[model samples]
Target: SAGLYDEARRGWLYPMDVNPAGQNAFKKDAWNKYRIECIGSSIRTWLNGIPCTNLVDNLVSSGFIALQVHSIGKNDTPGKQIRWRNIRIQTSNVKPSKADNIFVVNMIPNDLSAQEKKEGFSLLWDGKTTNGWIGAYKDTFPAKGWNIANGELSVDKAAGGESTNGGDIVTVKEYGPFELKFDFKLTEGANSGVKYFVTLSEGNKGSAIGMEYQILDDLRHPDAKLGKDGNRTLGSLYDLIASKKIANSTRPIGEWNRGFIRVNKNNKIEYFLNGIKVTEFTRGTPEFNALVAASKYKDWKGFGMAPKGHILLQDHGDRVSFRSIKIKEL
Candidate 1:
């Protein structure tokens, strides 16, 4: 049996109840067999040749068999644990097959697949070079602010000042209603953001001009506390909204984090981190209006009110890298 706790700590996999100091115990009878197998998306568990349960979940497809020994206690008088045996697992040995040449022949390089094409999507960064992107300021692209290293578009900190040398970059073509997907990796303590509905002027600078999809380290960044309450944390709308969930399910620093932003023609915005939707908001809604009214964006008329605008990558002066940047117009 698993111990239960009232609240679970971040990144811990055990169920809530297992006391940190109590001696939680589990024992398996001798000659008893526990078979766990995956049939499609369901996991079937049989204990002692008797079916116990079938769990259906899309979260994980497969994993290793584990027998846990839990004990509760801090330093001296903690709880104890147990032992488990006769454990076995059955797994599919066949790897998922790749598409054949016939199906691959129709695929375009650095372009949307047929399914995505049908949805009116396209590639923003043409895997090989930066053709449709330019520095945020002036007309010429920044020579040193960005680099294509090992297929990733990486920002070098020493190359320039925050938004001074490299500035922010935007798509050459403006989009009104669409969905965007990309992979990003951030250095520890680095700061950056993705902004949309961006309007550039001679004097105006910074992401305050439009709406921002904040990219930051929630656990370490000070900006996480700069906004009203905790609304300014990573994945929230900078200062106006809060992400429903923070996906700690990120790869370590320097590893890529998949992100998705969907803005519909009707002004609905959805944010996803690593394939898990963390937040959703409808623009122009009364509830959204209330949030804006109560937030730092109260005075701005077009705060998040644009019908269409350009997509921008923020240059917060830290080393942030992006790759597999693609988009689909919805």
Candidate 2:
């Protein structure tokens, strides 16, 4: 059984529930041998050749045994690895039974609560503390850069720089293919963008390392005037490709606008605004290659080619607000 902290920090397994039998035999970057015996609703464990006293919920009747290899390292040792062996299981003549449907709740809010929850959809933001989120540079939340006021996460303009005080704010967790929904409100004559496939390093400085979903007041910003025709407009994949559909769906200066981004397992990316599909791009295609070549990221190899990365909220020195940030992994 691998816990959430174990998966995030040590990287052995995916985030799941766990019940330890002994006095918490797991440690970061350190191994401990365990001997355990299971009976009816009880599992006795010995940690490192020492018998210990601990109790766990015996919800499992019978199951197969498994061994896991984990990766654990800090920024200094980026590619550390772990291993395990000598795994065996003892079973009686009893057969395993299936349990009933159990719902796993998410953190964010949504409209289709009943149906989404039944289908395993989750909310990413709870409109409160930034529990599952952190600044892209530092270990804690941004002090003067972002604020959750009046049920919305607003970007503070006065605290603006390139990763100086606080850079972008990303989810503490990462994702693969998923449908992300959020609402944003932008200031007039300001520029910003939301990016994905974001990998952090002591290397790259700006947003050009990953693919960015263009978020700007296209009608007023200077960047919207720089690209070919209107290629850099709002919802047009920044400066590379242009969105086909165009509607005046953006609310004025202080009003909120709904935005949705969906990425499938086949690497198909779709962008929607105000319930209209504005852009569709298939990654790793010849057309995508051509677009990347013509764009500013021509020199970079495999710029947006990662299957998974961090979700980033940008700070372009503008007053931007976001709410209802939720995602459903496919």
Best by lDDT: 2
What TM-score, computed on C-alpha atoms, does each candidate reach? 0.64, 0.63
Per-residue lDDT of 190-290 in model 1, one digit per residue for the tens?
A: 77888887766424564426678788776776788787767777677878887766435455676667677889777888876654566789988999899
Task: List the global CA lDDT of all models.
Answer: 0.63, 0.64
Top candidate when judged by TM-score against the true structure:
1
- Tens-place lDDT per residue, model 2, 161-257, is 4444346788878788988877788887766677777766425664425677777887777788887767777777877777664434455667666
Candidate 2, which ten residues in sequence have the lowest lDDT sum? 10-19
**What is the model-wide C-alpha lDDT for candidate 2?**
0.64
TM-score for predicted model 1 compared with the true structure: 0.64
Give the residue spans of candidate 2 off by over 4 A.
1-112, 159-165
